[model samples]
Target chain A: METSVLKSKLQSYRELALKGINHYVPKSEPRKHLYDLVMDYPSRGGKGFRPGLCISTCKAWGGNEETAINSATALELFHNAFLVHDDIEDGSEFRRNKPTMHEYNNIGIAINVGDAMNVLSIKPLMMNINILGPELTWQIFSEIEHMVRQSVEGQAMELGWRKENSKCLTEDDYLRMILKKTCWYTTIHPIRIGAIIGSKGKVNPDMFNRFGFFMGTAFQIQDDVLNLIADEKAYGKEIGGDILEGKRTLMLIDLIQKLKGSNKSKLINYLANCRNENQLDNASWVLDKMHEHGCIEYARKVSKHMAGAALKEFYTCFQNVEDSEDKDMIEALIMHMISRDY
Target chain B: METSVLKSKLQSYRELALKGINHYVPKSEPRKHLYDLVMDYPSRGGKGFRPGLCISTCKAWGGNEETAINSATALELFHNAFLVHDDIEDGSEFRRNKPTMHEYNNIGIAINVGDAMNVLSIKPLMMNINILGPELTWQIFSEIEHMVRQSVEGQAMELGWRKENSKCLTEDDYLRMILKKTCWYTTIHPIRIGAIIGSKGKVNPDMFNRFGFFMGTAFQIQDDVLNLIADEKAYGKEIGGDILEGKRTLMLIDLIQKLKGSNKSKLINYLANCRNENQLDNASWVLDKMHEHGCIEYARKVSKHMAGAALKEFYTCFQNVEDSEDKDMIEALIMHMISRDY
Candidate 1:
């Protein structure tokens, strides 16, 4: 499949998912302020990749887009809610090249908005009851339960690691964290939920686990790389923001291993200090060290390897299904996400 | 139905609900810190009023405690989650005589813990599939949907009121806010959900609404009065915390009415200022004025009237149902809550 064609397909699905999300524009007069804050990030428009993937997976599994739209919108809403909280926790200033929710509003209001969005997200899943019946809706609900639990657990690990300044961290530890944090919510659950819904509970959800793990990990590493090197305008986020936040990205873990003596101690001190205070100097210093040590290239290579493994897994999982545009797009997404500079 | 007997019944139900909640003490290693923070409030032991009401209501409708335990535990967990967020938003220092979650942990971490607890709370509700089966479980889920939506809407209203400084507020406004915020989650949904489960989804949930509204409102008014007048040791929370937060309590509204000219302006100035900055001196001055202007007495009268209405509503709702220990205790709890000094 051509990259341009795949991009167009992805855009169409994104538009469809956006339409589904517009169903919940939140018009309650009393709490309109909180609801307005919730629509902020979703309206700013990221890749819409989460919902796009969810809808595509459902289509590829022979389900209509309408059947998947509610779940897809839910995926996007939940992701944005997580991002709103994540921005506050990381003390990041920008999301999608705009002020983070807490930066635009106060932290208290931002938290309230995120909480409301979370509760609203549940509405769509429950709506599945009318469309999918009780048993299937219950299964999807349980899957969502696991997905939320895993994502929060992953977030806690990352936050705990930074708070404790855990120096014993390894590349494997970073991978494990992202697998729970990024992989499950980002790729695994979306595919699993979509597959189950599309197949009308016929598909074995566990079968998609390995493929989602590899694909989502690849996407995350590429994202980390883009944070360091991509133009801020193209990336739609602050360049090198992860280093400033002391996020345990693979590049950071690799750089830590390559550094010796004073460089190592300097990096350690920066991580130990308050991220908001040290962001600028820390980002520049870390970026320089990563470039000098070839850690960025190292992470890129690892990401490509993961993408390759994902391609292989994709063939195994989709082998039984008929060829379709949605299937092709899913394959294209894995490649595009891994290889894109922005 | 004597006061002591009612107290004993409430205590036993609280113990059962606590045991049920103990089943979900969150042991995930990566996020144990978050889970531990969540358990802190529930373990420190507030009255256990929410879950006790839920369990007893279930029993009164002829349901076994085992059938209600999961939902009861979920109610407690969800309530604690709200407390964690509410404390941060209100900037209170104490809950159940211990530091608030944000006071013990950073605001960022406390927010995450609350979010985690909110997610963890859903697992038990999902567990209802095995115990209650899908049809009844879906009904319960629908009830929770209303419960969470109402609670957040109520929170948004209260927060918006403080933010906008709505000086033309009436006692009717206070009632509307508390009805949404306190009454629904505290009384209405619990009885609705309990009756539905106990009657195997046969009861009309609407039947419990009026009864719950009056009972919960009476309970809330008594709680507000206790905050003003109860001894610190007996209250188990920071006395005058609500005044310090400039909460639009009935007594506060009454105090504003009783004051004249400069005193009214002075109080308005205090309410409009940042609460955290004004908490100490404002609490002292407001307490004095409440005493001087008979504001406390006025509030007590209103609360007593509400309690009387609740007692009448209780008989109307429960008269046709079988007379049991649970029913008798529910009747006694109304008088006990309103009449207690501490």
Candidate 2:
């Protein structure tokens, strides 16, 4: 399929998921401030990738929109809630081109807003009891349970690395961290959950594991790449912000491994001193070293390899399924995730 | 029941619930930091009032310890998680005489810990599926759903009042706020959840509504009074902490109503300026004013009246049930709650 066609198809799914989230997220009185902050992220909007993937996989597996919308919305709510906390933890200034929740509000209120959204997210999963019945609800709930644990574990790993200024990290270490942090919530659980809803609890959730891992890892590497290269407007966040936050990105790891002599100590000194956005000036030096070391090209090649592997795993997992536009979109998403500019 | 015996009875129930919580709260690696911070609040030791009421009421109505333990742990986990966030939100320093979670750790990590605990709390509640089965799990889930919403709504009310610095609050406004904030989770839902578990989904949850409201309100008033009058060692938190935080306690409301001229403006100035523990010196003046207006005395009268009503409602609800030690403990708890110094 052509790239634009696949892109349009994914955008439609994003729209559908947004509508479901809009319906599910509470907007009433009292703690309306909390709910309002929750809506802030989704309303400003990202790619809506999590819920889009969830709903698409559900539909591709023979479920209709109605059957999967609640769970899809739940996934999106959890994703946004994580972003709210992540921005605070990373000390990033912006998300989706606007002030992050903690920047717009105080850190205290921002934490409450994230906490409230986490609580509100549970509401939609409980709705599964009515839509899909107790047994399937448990399955979906268990998937979410595992997803949240893995994501937080991943987040903790990244935070711990930054906190200690650990310099001994390897590329393999980065992979393991993102696998827990990004892959599970980003691809694995969404696919697993969609299949559970689509198959009415009959799907082997384990089958999607390899496919999700490859695709989500590819997506993340591309994301890190874009953080360095993409225009700030196109990226919808501060360009080179990851370096400023001293994140253990693939490029950073590769740059550290490939550099020698004065470069190594300079990078270490830069990382040790740069705890927040104030060090953006030093960020470009790190970025230049990453580019000089072929870090960007290396990451791209690895992401492309992962995307190719994902396509193979996609076929193995979806071979028995019937053909549908949703199936096509899911397959095409692998290519889009790797090749997109934003 | 003598006060000592009643206290011992409640203590036993508290121990049972604590055992369940200790078993359920996650203690594994990777996210251990998050879970460790979670155990911080519960381990420092609260009165265990919520879980004690839950387990005892469940047993009194014919539920076994096995049937009620999970829900009881869940209530406690939720309560502790709330404390973690509430401390951050209210800028509170001491909890159970130790630094607040955000005070003990950085704000970012503390928020993550609270988020992780919120997620961990759900795991035990889901265990209800195995122990209590699907139908009743849904009932318990629904009860929790309402409890979380009410608690957040109530918290929002308190936070919003402080944010706006609105002095137009009446005693009725205070009651309405506490009804959502204090009464529902602390008293009403615990009893309602206990009855549901005991009756195996057969009991009417509403019968405990009035009983819980009066009991919880009285307990809160006593708690407020103890905050002022108890020894700092016995109080387990900073004395006069609530005044410094500008909490809209019943006593504060009463003091505001009774004061005239400069006294009113002075109290308002203290509230407007002192948002945190740094203003402890100013806190004593507000506390002194509360005494001068007979505010603490007035709050105690209202508390005694509420406790008397709670005892009456207790008889109306529990009279039909067969007598047991659990029932006796529930009966005696009213006296203990109203009369205790801490």
Model 2 ranges off by over 4 Å: A260-262, B276-278
Q: What is the DockQ of candidate 1?
A: 0.64
| lDDT of every model, 2 decimals | 0.84, 0.85
What does the lDDT read for residue B54 in candidate 1? 82
Error of 2 at B58 (Å): 0.7
Please name the candidate that would achieve the greatest lDDT relative to the true structure: 2
Per-residue CA lDDT of model 1 for B243-332, tens digit only, reads 887888899888888789998998998888746474577678989999999888988888778878888888888787899888877887
Docking class of 2: medium
lDDT of 2 by residue, B1-342 (tens): 787777776677667767777887666767445656667787887787888899989998999888988898888888888888888887778888788877867666777777776777778889898889888888888888888877777777777788777788998988888888889999999999999999888889999999999999999899989988888887787877788778899999888888889988888888888864367777888888888889999999999999999999999999899999889888888878888887
Per-residue lDDT over A228-257 for candidate 2, one digit per residue giving the tens place of the 0 to 100 score: 899889799988888888989998998888
Model 1's C-alpha root-mean-square deviation from the true structure amounts to 1.9
lDDT of 2: 0.85
What TM-score is obtained by chain A of candidate 1?
0.96
The weakest ten consecutive residues by lDDT in model 1 chain A span A24-33
